[model samples]
Target: MTYNLNRWQGYGHDRLYVNAGSRKIGWIDLKTGRVKVTSPAGWPSPIEGMVQQWLASNGLGHLRVKLKPRKRGDEITTQEFLDRIDRSRDDDQQPAVALSIKSQRRRSNAGTDLAKNRAGSAAYAAAQERSTWWRSLGRAMGMRTEDQAWRIGAEGEQIVARTLQWARLRGWRVLHAVPVGARGSDIDHVLIGPAGVITINTKHHSGQKVRAKPEVVFVGGAAKRYGQAAQYEANRAAKLLTAAAGRPVTVLSAVVIVGAKSVRGSRSAGVEIMPKSHLLVWLLFRRRTLSRTDVDELYELARRSTTWQPS
Candidate 1:
């Protein structure tokens, strides 16, 4: 629970909203359009200055909370979260969710952090690809646009489809990897059962260290490994989907390499962390059934989050 102060009450019919970290919280009854910081003294964060700087630079004057720092040596606990909320003064209390009255602002600063990743990275779902000034190059010969990652992140849909095929041959339903929300923005694998939804994230890592189970490796002493990245992605996806679905979505992420023929690690989850020399064999073994609803959801979700390159 977060405590918010209603300093925005007198905006006079203008709508407003605030961005809290990765999740956006809409404001209530005021303009939701971006504004600069007129007042700032609520949350506790080390990056307050940076946050203020960012908001101002983006033409966003008004600002709110941004980070959730864990203690010196502790992970964020529910008790701690509630305690922090309870202890904070409510001179102006803001709800976790905000409803605003301004027009939704278009994100338009410049140079996105996405510039720092695989084109196919899931970081920014609906980002427009960068543009070129070739048409205007003759007018300004020295002008140059930074190059974007030519390799778009792997399509989550392709990855999910492959999982469905792989799990089916084993007489199991690929239940948990579907998208279920109004916009289906949150992506996750959902295997709905009488017990509940079991979320699974299928990954394709090239390294030979079975990321899920790190013990099995024959490489140069686990040289540069994929640490908590896959799990972190899976966990985040689960949380978002859970919020969207209005319930907990159990999550399990597995790295299923399509080609690591040189792998020599033992399978931690009964599967080699290495890639298969023959991609066909890997697919054949993962055949599994899924409810039509789940399949449709996954496909639709994938479509929204994914597209294709015509071969």
Candidate 2:
């Protein structure tokens, strides 16, 4: 069968995708020469030869040495398979499992409405409270304290949740105040959509400037571990979802700063960083990486309270 080759230049490396008409067959990583085939029909006989010829013609023959070919009938996990869905097509096909997902979402939403696991609920619960009436009055008088930090953090998460309403209207599913691990920690927001899964860390630094380096972020000149925390959460979520789905799921991370006067950074130290205002635009414009079917199946697995509990 004849195939087409397309090259996409990414952040640091380039990818050569092999497609059979509209279906994505696989891709060749130009830097590593590692070939990954997602075709269920198995490795086609002519694909390797076609790839070799394309590389040679395009002056990428050096990558030939690193090529590791897979045997016919080799299978990839469900997660990898879903991630390999065609990016160019806006296919709205739903997975068979989606029928049950609708019920699950209804239950999850019911729980959310009761504030059982709603957005910012965890942060709001964790916020320190003034024991004395006088202390509450002191806080009302513009006192700065640890309680204030948590208060604003919860508010920031709520703001981001409102913004994510925009995402839901665009066919994306979002979860807020996801409880993670057994340490009483929680993820601010989790987004599932055409752009795949993302764990968002929301920070509110009202009237403060936020700056980021590759690995660290600064809020009002105070360095914080937002990047590392977000990446860690993404990794954990990926592992949990992969196990539940019986596949290798991939997750992305992002840090959204709310109420910041300005944001100065671009690179994601394993996570994307942006102000809350840009979150919607960034998510809406990202290349389509998941289909309606993929999103539904994953969201089905993610919304379960059991999914986040310690194993």
Query: Which candidate wins on TM-score?
Result: 2
lDDT of 1: 0.36
The TM-score that candidate 1 achieves is 0.31
The TM-score values for the models, in the order shown, are: 0.31, 0.62
Candidate number achieving the greatest lDDT relative to the actual structure: 2
Ten-residue region with minimum lDDT total, candidate 2: 95-104
lDDT of each: 0.36, 0.73
How many Å off is the CA of 145 in candidate 2?
Answer: 2.3
- RMSD for all candidates, in order, please: 19.7, 13.1
Candidate 2, after superposition: displacement of residue 221 in Å?
Answer: 1.5
